[model samples]
Target: MKPKCISKLKITGTKRILQISLPSRKCKSIRVSPLESRLNTGCANSPKNSSSPLRNEQNNQKFISRYIARVLAKPEFQNKKRPIKTAATHRRTNSDGSKEPLSARNNKLSGGKSSCKNSDSDEKTIKKGLGIPNPDIQKTICRELSKKKLYKTNDTDEIIREKLIEAITLSFKTTNSAPNTSIDFYKLGKQIGNGAFGKVSLAQNRLTGHKVAIKIIDKSFIKDERTRRKIFQEVFIMKKLNHRNIIRLLEVFESNKNVMIVLEYAGGGDLLQIIKARGRLTEDECRGIFYQLIEAVKACHNMGIIHRDIKLDNILLTSDYTDIKLCDFGVSRFAKAGEKVDEQCGTPAYLAPEIIADLGYEPFYVDIWSMGVLLYAMLSASVPFKAKNLHDLHKLILRGKYDVPEYFSAEASDLLNKMLNPVPHMRISLEDMKLHAWYNGFVPENILDLSFNVTRQNEILSKMMSYGFPRDYVIQSLNLKDVNHASATYSLLDLESSYNYT
Candidate 1:
């Protein structure tokens, strides 16, 4: 025979003991005998081996309590108060002083005036009324109810409604602790690319159904604590940068054996692949791509960041090939004005003469020199300072021995010469490069304006969304800025802070 359903349950007194109300035999559709009903309602039968229905129900409750206890043990819920119990009685006396049934008592609990003043206190009272073992356990139980999409006041069941409120509030305590769960949230696809650091694969978010690139790095390859710290620093820096011409870091997941970084999927591949396919680009085409690259570099500098390794391979193209994103900050560094970096990092073909000199060099100057080499490669399909060995390459770079192809425009050669000057102090600054005669008519005047440029506005919006801001709210914030006065001179942090987004 099926067990009779519970009619009502409530918590009573300061200790918050659970009180249950069993169905009355006088009610309609009584399936069991009055003795059976009374036996089932009171307690389980005392049998050594026999299974009783009431015993099963008690076991289920205990199972739930154990699960809740496990969830409560999480550090986030440690200091939370125990679920408050409502001062609800088993029965209410009517106008004639007659005690109402379990159904009427449930109605009173569900729809009657709440004794608490605020929603927080009401939630506490409901949790107490449910007789949850502790606050943490109560929070976990509520989250489960919320995931099931339970409605508090709308649900006819009082027990379910109380559980829903508890869950909705518990979800507000979001944590940034390294996730201990499996990577089941992402549906990994076929491998798309690979590098010395990691392999990139296409993956889809199981929740949002959005496609992204996942870079999975092997922890064993990191070798030292310094390298591990750099990996974390890269993640931290990328999270702060929000630019249209820079790849977005969507999320990071780390495990004992590997680290996974989710990024914007650039389907058109890197500029190197495109260059290899097309051999060389026309001057106009080169001008457009070069303009975007400079703008990206300018943005990075404004934020006090230096992309130590700036090469054709580090620049990725969007699917349509109309724009490029500067990525791979593995060797990048944060620099203050006038600070010098001594590291001899970056690809050999693109390393600046100052970097090859083994002397401390300003990172910004090294970046400028690298951009010159990149520009040369884009127009000529070959690196300017090529040699048979590192020794020969260093000698050639030190001598500043690079011949500009005659086919290149005079304006391009002039800018390249200024940028590739062997003396770091003589290298062209980013501000000067923007106003060069070559880019005067080719690039837009407001290309670097974050507020006026639609691409930049969209990039800022995308970043704010990643930070959990609503889309409408981000749009409203962006629209409030004065477009004409906002310049690329402002750092991303400065612009974002101006709008009070943090």
Candidate 2:
């Protein structure tokens, strides 16, 4: 107030803060150290001989400030650049394919929803994963079935494929034609899994005797509006998603008390189950599963959808375990190009750093990060980052701390790093993924989805019309992405025959 108090400071390259303060009127000086007054007033004993309270206070403050500044400034300490503390002897290969010591790379770095509806706790997810050392008798049976089926999945098996489609079509048409149907069309079987909302059971199409997994959700238990919208959103997304690697939503049935979602059954169980049943997967085996996953994710991205959750639990195995089906779209959302969403929702471990940062995140990039986590799990049989609690988990994620198993191939490790990059703008994309060396010579199969294939639209329409579903109604449902009996009927045919993977 007296002279518009001015102060300035210039820190040296050695990286220590210089004492700084503005002058006060009572001080009658142009400048002063913040500690100057304390030095003057509390020097009861001679400074040279003093072990006084004032001296102790001054030392304490100085020590604390310096410690904090160093922690905040040092590259190695700042933001916890190196997560897992190890001796300098350990080395990790850099992204550029060069090896560097843990100490040499001194720095680096920079950067939940519901139980029943696909937001299981980290504890539960971990417990369910990497715990089973061997597959039970049932998984072994499915494995055998899978190998047998794989041998039959060839061009010569066209008749078999047609028969399968016919079976699916007959189930849809016969069950839908039944009078006053809700869940009556399905004969619910054994409970496969259960949660607060309800149980997921093995069910049969009463008309065609096809086995499916029906998720029974009690409406009253899902009391919140957000949870209800999540249900709608899940249906909205899964209906539009018709990829060879995605679990198909056969149909939805609603009544006064519950909503039953009939989905394609994966008898071999989820990826987590298979991982537990057999120790970790070999790189080649993991690559096969991962390749299908990449295709599945591309399909989702092409449809402008973001599957926020992409962990082990949601990856189901086909009856023969020949392939995987990416399921659980309960947390998926539609995000236009470059749009950022602020809502934070997903499993704790699979969440991208930006989502944990509480900043708006590009939904598509978030999927890539989660995919990286998935690959890590498949390779090592453990999550990349883990902590005792949510808060610590967030800390680990923000620091970009994770160990690459010694067994990983250079290509596999490099691809994983690109996908898990902390910077959103720098993250590897699905298109770029096709060029990555890890996928070299790994030709993608005849990928297909439930999209409108103009070339074959007329032909398929004629075929469906032959089946008695009015051409106009079928066309409208497919175009509108409606989740109902017609859409289900279309899927049985489209996923089996129509809709190119392009």
All candidates: TM-score = 0.56, 0.60
After best superposition, candidate 2 residue 368: deviation in angstroms?
Answer: 0.8
C-alpha local distance difference test of each model? 0.51, 0.54
In model 2, residue pairs whose N, Cα or C atoms come closer than 3 Å (at least 3 residues apart or on different chains), thus clashing, are 132-276, 146-320, 447-501
Error of 2 at 324 (Å): 1.8
Native-to-model Cα distance after best TM-score fit, residue 7 in candidate 2, in Å = 73
Candidate 1: where is the Cα deviation over 4 Å?
1-182, 443-502
Cα deviation at 217, candidate 1, in Å, is 1.8
Name the TM-score of candidate 1: 0.56
Scored against the true structure, residue 241 in model 2 reaches a CA lDDT of 74
RMSD of 2: 24.1
- Residues 1-502, model 2: lDDT tens digits: 0011112324432211112222232211112122111100000001122332222333344543453343334453334322221111111100000011111112223313321223221334322321212234323332332233322335333454354444435544554321222454455777776533566788765434556787788888667654565566666667667766788777776667887777877666665554554556567666667777777888887877777767666777665445567876654666666656655555556667766654455557788788888888778777787766655666666656688878999999988877766655555666666678887765544333445567566766776665455677677766766555555655655544543234
Backbone clash pairs for candidate 1 read: 84-124, 84-128, 85-128, 85-129, 142-167
Report how far off residue 495 is in candidate 1 (Å).
Answer: 18
Total backbone collisions for each predicted model: 5, 3
Candidate 1 lDDT by residue in tens digits, 413-439 = 988977776655555667667678877
